[model samples]
Target: IIQGYGLTESSGSVASTVGPEESKAYGSVGKLASHLQAKIVDPSTGEALGPGQRGELWVRGPLVMKGYVGDDKATAETVDSEGWLKTGDLCYFNEDGFLYIVDRLKELIKYKGYQVPPAELEHILQSHPEIADAAVIGYPDEDAGQLPMAFIVRQPGSNLTRQQVIDYVAKHVAPYKKVRRVAFVNAIPKSPAGKILRRELVQQALSMGASKL
Candidate 1:
């Protein structure tokens, strides 16, 4: 099976892994579709990035919508005057032009000066044998700006500790991306479609008013 990427605003698929050869790229969603022009842009600097650089994927094409109906403000923020639609997804193109989605642009954890993708940490946390599910969020911190915090659900009868979760993620990621705090939850809040309801967790964390797990 092939993977693809697009949104309702794009009028359907913008990129897809076509044949067997391109499908070999594994995690990539393939190259841009015909009549579609795409560019990777640095979200912070708005500078166009080259291949292998992780940034927001912007696309322009006939297939793209004119604007959101009755929502000019939202339309203006999403689609630029020049017609490039900011996909709001953090992605990168490989040397072969295959697109690799990292995570949602807004969901990134800002730790110190580095941008850490929470999905990366969540993936590591969920990989542990004792972990049933996991979600990562940007916890508030004065000095670090934000620290990577994990809300984890342990496997049945498992007794995983917060430090164990931290160490597991630390081993798989850089020092900046380490899980600084962990909370063992019965279940992670999620949408009906299985997307993590991170805002809820963030609010819960704030309500708790404690940094320690």
Candidate 2:
């Protein structure tokens, strides 16, 4: 499948599948264009990571946006002094240099100081025949710092139970990654581009006094 990575801020795609030979690689956004430079860096330390090491993706190229209009603070936060735009996306490159997007760095769930990627749980939840869609967020917990919580949309006529949801994830992931809280909803809020509106769900969970699963 043809795939590319781009954002409105970048004007358009800076990387895409080049040809039939490159299109054979699965789960990649293809190689970067000649004029563009990209790197995967440790989000906390800014240290560059090697291929196959997942980290925050950064890009610097003519295609990158100059700055946000009339928003110096936002611009400063996004574009570093070296002109590299912090994409906020977690990704890694394969040995063949194909880029693979993971999940958003900001959306990672922290449980007992361990970082848990919400997308990993969401993916597993969606794989269940009884679940149509899912979104995962970290809810504040005094002890664990944050607890992984899931907002699920069940398949039509499916009678999935909360225990089943917890058990399913528990069996698939490490003990720390199991979803501890769950809320079933009619639908998951998403953007026009189909991106999960995680912030909205986080707020909704808080307003509903989100509790244990």
Candidate 3:
């Protein structure tokens, strides 16, 4: 199937795979549409990044909305004065100009000074044979801004331990991106659309006390 990317603010899709040939790029959402200008910028520094560098995606085009209806404040925040609409999505482009969305910018976890994507950790966790499902969240920390915490559901009849879960993720990720905390749960909280309700998990974690887990 052809992959594409867009939002309501952009009126519709601003990029899409042309055909089966371009769709072979795997995770890419193809190239930018005509009349659309796109750029990837370092989220922290706002510096325009080159290919293979992950950053926030900005788009400018005639199709983009002038403003957010009556919300001037929201409009000013999303679309800059120069007409570049901040997509608020962490993404990167391949050398061929194909866009790959990593995750939502706001969902990123700050561990030490490094930005860790929860989706990355969740992917690794779910790959384990003992793990039936998983969701990752940023656990609050004093020294580090946030730590990667996992809420896991084990496979039927599996007897997985917290240390085993932690070790499994540590082997597959960088030191900073390691899953430092884990809690076994019956099932992961998800919305009707199957999107993980991370905010609910965060509130549950806070109520249970981080130290206890």
TM-score for candidate 3: 0.94
Q: What is the lDDT of candidate 3?
A: 0.91
**Model number with the top TM-score:** 1
Q: Candidate 2 on 1-213: residue-level lDDT in tens?
A: 788888877778867898888998887889987788999999889999999999998999987999999999999999999899999998999988899888888888889988899999998999999999999999889999999999999999999998899999999999999999999999999999899998899889888884434
Off by over 4 Å in 1: none
Candidate 1 has a TM-score of 0.95
In candidate 1, position 208 carries an lDDT of 72
Report lDDT per candidate. 0.92, 0.90, 0.91
Question: Which ranges of candidate 3 are over 4 A from the true structure?
Answer: none
TM-score of each: 0.95, 0.92, 0.94
**lDDT, candidate 3, 1-213, per-residue tens:** 899999888998978999889999997888888879999999779899999999999999999999987899999989998999999999998988899989999999999989999988888888899899999999899999898999999999999999999998889988999998888899999999799999999998888896678
Superposed by TM-score, candidate 2 places the C-alpha of residue 63 at a distance from the truth, in angstroms, of 2.0
Model 3 alpha-carbon miss at residue 166, Å: 1.0
